[model samples]
Target: MPTTTALPPSVLISEVGPRDGLQSVSRTMPTAAKLAWIDALHGAGLREIEVCSFVPAKLLPQMADAAEVVRHALGKPGLTVMALVPNLRGAEAALAAGVHKLTLPVSASAAHSLANVRKTREQMIEEIRNIAALRDERAPGVKIEAGISTAFGCTIQGAVAEDDVIWMAEQAIAAGADESGLSDTTGMANPAQVQRLFKRLRAALGEHAGAAHMHNTRGLGLANCLAAYEAGVRTFDASQGGLGGCPYAPGASGNVVTEDLVFMFESMGVDTGVDLGRLAAGRAALANGLPGEPLYGMTPEAGLTKGFVYANGRRPATERLLAPLAP
Candidate 1:
């Protein structure tokens, strides 16, 4: 049997609550509340956040204040503000907002491509190329991420061929994207499949391979994340309270819960640069922003395990719990 090495000492947890989470909900969070949530998340030690998407407000009223939100997020020191752009027009607006990173979702499944963006796979790739050119001309220093959504299996078209996903990653990279990654938009991925696909993605893109965006729709979110970790994926995308889902993906659930994912890595002695206690506290903001929306997680409900030590060297949760009250 082959010996397995320990996971990396640190991992990047890119929070996507503001973009992916809010977009799926019908009620739009007020701009002030959105800013508060972003602030609370940043205070929890999250260095990277997908603040908002550059889409038409008429389509997604939840993201109407995208530019304003981006501007506020930029004021936070040390936070890498990222935004999702659908095409060249969105990319132009995102660049004007001075976002640090811009992610473009290019669906691997043809049916998903048509349903989500009303474009075929080839046309989307051409759009990505144009967006890349615009980025080079306007903001050469900004990073572009081509996130291949529905890379696992699509609800619209079942059993997306792995070859098609790999080809899309190659095409995105070849078209001038700075990085490319996979997204299980429909939450149909298993652990074994996660490991296999991510390994192939890394081999194909090498240094350009990016974050693993997994959903918890089928309840395999964390398991798939571990598999990806074992396969050499360091950056993981997650949302607070597991908010948000793909509008086109029937029965699709939200992204992986940020608190649970952070707890998983921290318990394994892997530093995520986030404070679990503080991260959980940010949930109050989520609740206030999207009142009545269902939030899900295990660690926040059960509290940290007994004698739990944080990755950032904070005192164990148990110790903090058992400590005598300070006068």
Candidate 2:
């Protein structure tokens, strides 16, 4: 029998493609194809996936089948089905859908908050409080995560104050969020800022410190994720093929690529519990679902290094050493 190699998972990679990727695009993916793409992602060992958003169909028709998608995902054993919700009503809908988790989008930038969700940061926190209360009443098992968008910098309000971001995160937590994570909605985050902000977040929130949601708009997505990892962040939000962004937030495009981020960590001996080859199959499903749409990822295009070895004791037949290069 072949040796059973099981390296303990070092990090949690929450995939946001099924929701964010589809919502940002102009066309709606057929329900069958959406389910297939999700199956592919699950097949690739993606444990957590934000399958859809529970908003009004008029607002985001692409996510109209949120409940059906959640139902399909629920059939997958060991998979956490998550959905995005903006307000208490959305949370109720998601709870009804039987999702495993709910991620609420709360923009740290007041301007972006109003533009995206039509509410102020203070009001959003109150909404979170209500949503959490409802969750406690309806489905206590589901986790509620607050994703603070534009936490790094806002396209509408450039250069958001770091203090403001921290304050917003604290407010969300106090308002009853299980965890609060920051998002580079405009893709303006750098490695230094990422490290500093996440460090402060960990200190303030302690165990409540959440995932880093970085974008590849300016090509620093992977670097920022690495910085967050160094700052003790274990959960990361990434999209398949870099297919995600905010339609409300101008110039905010390209979520951190799932393939590249997984490769970055696994290559550095930090197990992401993701198989690159399997991930490519998921990518193919994504591409097939939305034909003619371009997908992006250096790891997918450049291919994994020869004799690559995963931190989890899995590797090619000719295993090569993975290490840092001498400067």
Candidate 3:
């Protein structure tokens, strides 16, 4: 019998605040402020960030400057700039903007597919194929990530089948996605369900399985993320200040907060390569960009545990222990 390898002590937290967090809000963050926020996140040790979406401005005005934002993100050293695309058209724009990775969300729930992308599950898979082909032709180096939204369950249809989620992941892989992953778009997942599904997803997709995108709507976001991590997931998608939700998924709140997620891993002796103090300071951009927007996080509010140490050696011990007291 073969022994299972232990999960890595460090995890990659892919910041999605600019794209996911900003999209759900009504106010559009100015491009300058968005760039500042991205810089701050990068300064805090984040390597990957979903800068913006390539959808039309008319549909989501908040992302009207997607191209500009992507360009700015690309200028950051060592940053893997990611952009979300709804279809091939959006993919083309993202490619032109020189994104390092492209995330294409395909709804696992039929009702969500129709409501969110106006396409059936099958049709979205076809779009994935088209986008993959385009990526190969134009930007073969860029990675294509198929994010299966509403994989946990849907508000409209309810009770999304586990089989369907697995099937969709397989289809995305077959359709040319570099990797496929599950998303708790509706925030209806529990720790047990997350562990089970991520295990199944890894079994099905193997190394091609992608990041875990969890929402904190039901207050189980961090728990669900930990479950996925225990189930062999390494990359996580989180938003600063827990500010995002699917417009089509009713009652869906922001994603798992980055500050809290980092605190969880760093406190557990797992390295997330993020500095809590700098990450907390980065929130100033969030506050400045979207004033009055409710930000949520435990660490940001309570501050890091006394004598906390980051897994990475980016911050000195004295600096690490001197995190600003939360107000």
Residues 134-203 of candidate 3: C-alpha lDDT, one tens digit per residue: 8899989999999999999998999999999999999999999989989998878999999999999999
Q: Which segments of candidate 1 are over 4 A away from where they belong? A: 1-8, 247-253, 316-327
Give all candidates' CA lDDT scores.
0.89, 0.87, 0.87
Model 3 C-alpha lDDT versus the unseen true structure:
0.87
Going through the candidates in order, what is the number of backbone clashes in each?
0, 0, 1
How does candidate 2 score on lDDT?
0.87
Query: How far out, in Å, is residue 320 in model 1?
Result: 8.9
State TM-scores per candidate: 0.92, 0.92, 0.92
The full ranking of all candidates by lDDT, starting with the best, is 1, 3, 2
Candidate 2 local lDDT, 22-133, one digit each (tens)? 9889899999989988998898789999999999999899999999999999999999999999888999999998999999988889899899878888999999999989
Q: Per-residue lDDT tens digits of candidate 1, residues 139-217?
A: 9999999999999999889999999999999999999999999999998999999999999999999999999999888
Model 1's lDDT to the true fold?
0.89
Q: Top lDDT: which candidate number?
A: 1
| Deviation in Å, model 2, residue 12 alpha carbon | 1.0
